[model samples]
Structures are given as structure tokens and as C-alpha cells.
Target: MTRPSNDSLNAAWDLIDHSQLILVVMHTNPDGDALGSGIALTLGLRQQGKEAHLVCPQPTPLIYEFLNPGDIVEPEAPAGVPDLAVVVDCDRADRVGALQGLVNQARRVLVVDHHPPTSDFGDVRLSHDGYAATAEVVHYLLAHRSVPVTGRMAEALMTGLITDTGGFRFSNTRPETLEMAASLARAGASVADISRRVYDSRTLAGLKLLARALASLQSSPAGTVAWARLSADDFAETGAAPEDTEGFVNVVHSLRGADVAALLREEQPGVVRISLRSRGAAVVSQAAEALGGGGHALAAACVLEASLDDAEERLLQELRKWTAF
Candidate 1:
């Protein structure tokens, strides 16, 4: 993994130190990485006596209720404009959703992300795709600036590392990743507790949603591609929120002969959300970008303005262009 340059790290520190009220923003529909990194940074800044706030465009998912760092409010135009806005775990400005306008109002923007940037917007961009999670990058940044990593910060950072690596099972798991996990563990992060809460804990509604998604699973003729669809009715019948679909795509991605997996869900009446996953060889981000979405190479997502069936067909065609099957 490429290391963050000292120049960028120093610049980020200068920006943070000079700023009194800092606003930390994460992407909409935040996953573990986005929430973890954002919360960790906010807490760290507050510990340093800075007025830092973490804001999201959507509510935090129930699954992450355990790592509550307090006061993660929904995005709004602040009463006093912040000196610096730090956007975390988002590849593009649009990913910030409604928060983009508020972020733009800041005097300066600093983007802290692990995904490759889709556009240039931030005044100080500290992004490197080599890191497995944005939390890892944030950890490095804090360490470089000599900020103490508190137990709570360690737990939040560990959550990002564990969730993004799929419990250290994904190909992104490197020696440095494990070493960082070990450091967080030494700093009071509980691996067993985190894994249990994140991966094992699921509500009945979530299980029902997963069952429905698996029941609708299909595959290509050559068995190289596996796909599934869940309509809005499935969400209504199961009483599951959109966040309940988290990690559901992994089920199809684990198929024996499947090199690529796609999950199409009707997030709203006329809006379909498509998630794509691969076994590392296939660059699924290309397909996601083609559909006006963006993410990592192995895991990506896109939302389409079409019915579930139409979105599935369109995604399958895009997947075919990238995968052999």
C-alpha cells in the first residue's frame, strides 16, 4: 500500500489546527467505513479542544448503534459556517448528498477517503486507494499529528477495518491491515465483541429480507455470474429498512462458480439500487461507473431510475462487458 506523504499530512494538520469549528461529513447511506472514520475524526478533534461536529445526510444505521460517539446530526446549514469541512469515506462530491451544499459553504474542504476520487473538489485531498478502509487512513493521519488514539477511537477505527475487510476475509487484508488491527486491539478494541455485534447480530426482519433476496437468486448460463433482485414489496412484507440489505449481496457473491454477483433492489417505487461484487479479478467499479455509481474494484454500487427488472437487465449487460461470462 502506498503511504500518505508527509506534505499532505502536514497540510491537513495545519488546516485542522487553524480551524476552530470543524465540520466532518460522510457519504449518504453510510456504511461502517464512512461512519467509523467520520466519528473517530470528530472525537479526536473534540479531544484536542476543537469544536468538531459529525454530520450525515441520512440517519446512522441501527447496526452501528453500539459505537455511538454522540451527536451525529443530520446535515443542515449550520448557524455559523465552519472553518474547514472534512469529508470522509466518499469518492465523489455527489456522494455527500444534501450535505454537499453545506460542505461547499465551508472556507476550505479536506477530503479524507480511501476510494479513488471521481472529481477534484477539496482544497486538501488526502485520499489513497491502497488503504483497505478510510479508518485506516484516518488512524495514520492522527498518528502523524501526534494525536492520542483513545479507546473509543480505537473501537470505531476497528469497526471500519473489520466491516470493510469482511472480518479480515477479503483480498484487501494485508499484513499492514492485520498489524493495524492488532494495534487497535491493544488499544482496547474488542475483536470478538465487534464481530459479534456487526456480523452476527441481525433482526428478524433482516433475516426475512435476506431469505427473500436469496430465494430470488439467479445465475448466468455459464454460472460465472450470479444475481438477485428484491422488490419494494419485499421490504414492505419483511418490514425491513433499506439499511437491512447491508451485507446481503455477499451471499450471492460467495457462490461456487460465480466470478461476479449483482443485487438489484427497488429502494423506491421508481428507483433501483444495484450492488456489484467480484472475487478480485473482475473490476466491478467500471460497471458501476457506467451506471453512474462508484466504489472499489471488488465492491461497487449504482442507483438507476428504472424498475427492478429493467435495472437488473441493464446491470447484467454491464457486468458482461467486464466479466468473461
Candidate 2:
């Protein structure tokens, strides 16, 4: 909400304006907001006659393929080292995976994010948790500069807004959020099309994985903390990847009397990835931060180096400490 400061925010714009070559990146395993904002920014920059490329640690997830061009995002940076790099929807450079080296090599870096702060890395950090998603920040900046919101940019930014706000159903959806959405809709972003593609287009493998995740659901004695687990075997058997597990934790959060929900997936024998979501006064990010992850107050994530059993107990303890319920 404090913005990257007025001066810092302007400096970010100045930096982008002056730079000729730019690289845009998001966190590893990016969600809709990260991907959407990244695409919109890259396209906007290119429209202004600057050279911009988007480099992600992983390939685009299947569900989001519709919003991306075939060659828009790549796993590797271009041969030429960019003069400026803009980190979108992410606060830490390390979260961009092996590409952090390339980011460091850039003459300057600007971080545009909507998460609570974790570490400071970029020269200009536009960290605003007040906005519902990073895409909103991009849209506002574009508007401030009087940049035309093309249909492509509108659709991409709309994807960011709708997905991160859980289709405008989450607590983060402010009046401004709805206004931005309405504006994008006016600019030719189709709400019905985006909803169907993002929320209702899961693959058959993903559906099987969701079923397994539901079957593994468990809860605390008071049912205030609900959780589910998935082994590597579950993914293999279901032919689903980590991306398929997206939003599964939210399903656990829907449990009656649950203030906090978690989904723990064993990526391998000893490592487990966890997602946490909360309702009411629970600040799940505090627990996630303690677990070496970071996100918003209502939603967060972390990874565990311990066995699945130990990881579950550790996450439960942290969630219990943070949740009033």
C-alpha cells in the first residue's frame, strides 16, 4: 500500500523508459497472476518500441497456454544480457531460479510485486500488498503512463486479476479491483472465456489428482486446521504434475470450521511442497514465512526438507500458532 514510494515508483518508470533492452521474469512455477502480469508488461514494453523478453524458470503451465503466444516465454535468457530486468509478482531474485544470475548481471533490476516483503533485491521494489494482484499494479502503471490497453494486454491482465482474487471471491477483492476488472472487460477481455479456460479446463489427469487430494484430507481436533497430502506416487498414478495440484489447498480450506488449510505434496522421497490458505483472522503467511516461504496474509506457501510425516506436523504447529480458530 505504501507503494515502492512515489519517488521510487517514478524511478521505476524512468528506468524502464531509459532502458533499450529489458528482460521480464516471474517466480518459479508461476501462477496466473505472475504469468499474466509478466506477459502484459512484456507486451506493453515491446509496443513502446523497446526490446523485451520474458524468461521463466519453468515452461508455461497448460491451463494458461491460451493467454501466451507460442514463443513468448522461454526457459533461457537470450544471448545478449539485458540492460534492465523487471521482476514481476516476485520479491526475491532467487525465486526466479537459476535465472537470478542473469538478473544480477543486468545493470538495474525493478521488482513489481503484491506480496508482503521477504527480502529486498531489486533496485526499485514496487511492493504493494494492498492491490489484489501484481497484474493490477502493472495495469495502474500502464494507465498512469497513458499506455493504451490493447485487447491482448486486457485479456492477460484480466487473467491475473480473476485468478489471484479467486474469481473476485477472495477477501483481497477491493472496489478498485472490481473497477479495474470492469475496465479490462470494456477493453475486450472476456470474463466468461477466461473463467472457463482457467477454472473449468483442468485436464483429466488433474481431475484424478484432485480426487486423490480430497481423499487424503485430514483435520485438527477442533477442525480448525484442515490439510491434505499427496505422495509422488499419487501424481505418477494419476499422470498429473505439480501444476495440476494448483488450488487443491483451497479445496481443503472449504472444510467446515476450518480457519487454515494446507496441501502437502511430496516432490520426492524427503522433500515436500506445501501450500497454506486461511479464512477470517488467520495469517497463514506468518506460518509460511517461518517455514521459509512468503505470500499474502490469507494465503502462503513453503517447502519442507523433512519427511512427509515430520513436515505435516511442523506445518500444523505453525498454522496452529497463527490461527485464532
Candidate 3:
């Protein structure tokens, strides 16, 4: 979809105004960008005299505990249907989990996301691969409509911007992204606090989980493609949650000669989840799409029909083709 314009911004605002209760949902196993953008948008909508609440499938990362002061509700919902629902950072309705029913049952829907989507599930869609984060798109949208940004809102937006852009290390980070970060910082976002909370608060289980992933790492074809497979038993042994496995693929991508990385996680007995990362001269999303998934050029993911070992081998074969070395 196209980037939302000023006129489109007004249309979104108009939609918000007419809707009585706006239900906001984000992707499952949400990262900082997903949680931050959804929460910030919820806060922004409430400040604008609208009734807004956040619902997600899984609990947010423990690092984000500093953001809010309550339990993440896994609501036994379907309380009628919402007047309007906004999906942020979710590419597909299935990513919304139990709320998928609510999205289907809602009267109107809008999807505002940064990822290249696999599904066109929104009545009004605003998707831009150019933006570094969905927080960036939503920030500009709110700023265009003269929506006031509180101190808390600034903090949330900054968290999304920093985390998704790899603290500005990722290739997607642009000059405008930095400028937006500066603006958010100036508007009362604390870089030190966000950094400390997100990066420095690793749990003991997370550390052990990282150790297991590192131990399982493998390289192929002169180390152009690196990979690791994590099983449910590994998580049980390490006492780590699923979110702890996040970014383990990046460890492989960081290898000196490795241009691409894959993490094949056995989420269930027969279900394998594939997460792909690429640095340069490789298009990970293409491989993901070939497996019925989609995301950005640098990072993408897919669910494999095969078992763990088979999925890992299949992904390794695909990654081998992308490597020049």
C-alpha cells in the first residue's frame, strides 16, 4: 500500500472521531516496536477523547514492563463487536490471535504498519517499507493532525524507533529516522532509560537461552549462510520464554563471513518457525515469500510445512543460493 498523505491522515482522524470505542491490536509475540507503537497509539487516542484499549495474544517482552503498570490482558473477549479497530504492526489478521474474530466482526478496520504485508486485511491500509518503524509512520500521522504528544507518548514512540532500527544500526535507518529520534528525545523521551531497560535487563534464563543457541549454531559454504535450530526442549531446559529466542538469528548474521542467517524454531511438535536475516547482496523476504511468508528485504519469516530438521535443511539450501561466496 501507499504511504498515508496529509489528506489520508485527516481521513484516519475522521474515522477515529466517529468511532466510539477503538480496539487496537498488535502482532503476536510483539517486539518493542509492536508493543510501543500499539500502546503509544492507544494513549494518543485516549488523549484525543476516544475510548481505546490494547489487546494482544501474548504477553509483551519483560523488558517493556517499565512502560505500563498492569498485567497484559489475555482477554476472554468477543464482547459484541467494535465500531472501529486499528491494527498496528500486524501484517495479517491471524497475527492478531484471538482478536482475529474481533477484527473480522468489527464494522471498520485500518492497518498501519511498516512491514511489507502478506495479507490485505484492512479496509483502509497504510503501509510503507521506506519508514524505519511503524512508530515513525504513526508519529508523522499524529503530528500532521496536531495530536498532542505527551511525555509518556514520546517515550513509547522513541522505544519503537530505537529498538526496530537496531538502535540506529540497521541499514533501514535513515537521516529522517535520526531526525525523528531527535525530535522525540527533545519532546521528553529518555534515551538512557530506554536503552538501559531494553538492552541491559536480560534475564538469567535469556542468557542461558542465548548460550544454547550459540552452541547449536552452524555455518555452511565457507560461512556465507549460518543457522541454528532451537527446540521446545531447549527452551524448557533453559527456562526461557519464546521471546527469549528473538534476535538469536542475528547472532548468526553477525558472523564475519556470513551474509545471511536462519533460525529454525520448533514452536510446536510439528510446526517449525523460520526467521531469516540478511545483511547485503541477499533478499531474505523473497525466500520467505517462496515459503508462503513475507516481510522486509533485510529481515523476514515463514512457517514451514516440514519438521524441524527438514525445515532447517530447506532454509539452509535456500540461503546457500543467495550467497555469492
Highest TM-score scorer: 1
Please give, for residues 105-126, the per-residue lDDT of candidate 2 as tens digits: 9999989888877788888887
Off by over 4 Å in 3: 1-3, 69-80
Q: Which candidate ranks first by lDDT, i.e. highest? A: 1
Checking candidate 3 for backbone clashes, the offending pairs are none
Two-way lDDT contest, 1 vs 2, winner? 1
Candidate order by lDDT, highest to lowest?
Answer: 1, 2, 3
| Model 3 Cα lDDT, one tens digit per residue, 82-189 | 888999997777887777878888789988888776778887777777888999888987887678888888888999998888778899888888888898899899
lDDT of each: 0.88, 0.87, 0.80
TM-score quality measure for candidate 2: 0.95
Q: Estimate the overall C-alpha local distance difference test score of candidate 1.
A: 0.88
Which residue pairs in candidate 2 have backbone atoms (N, alpha carbon, C) closer than 3 angstroms, thus clashing?
none
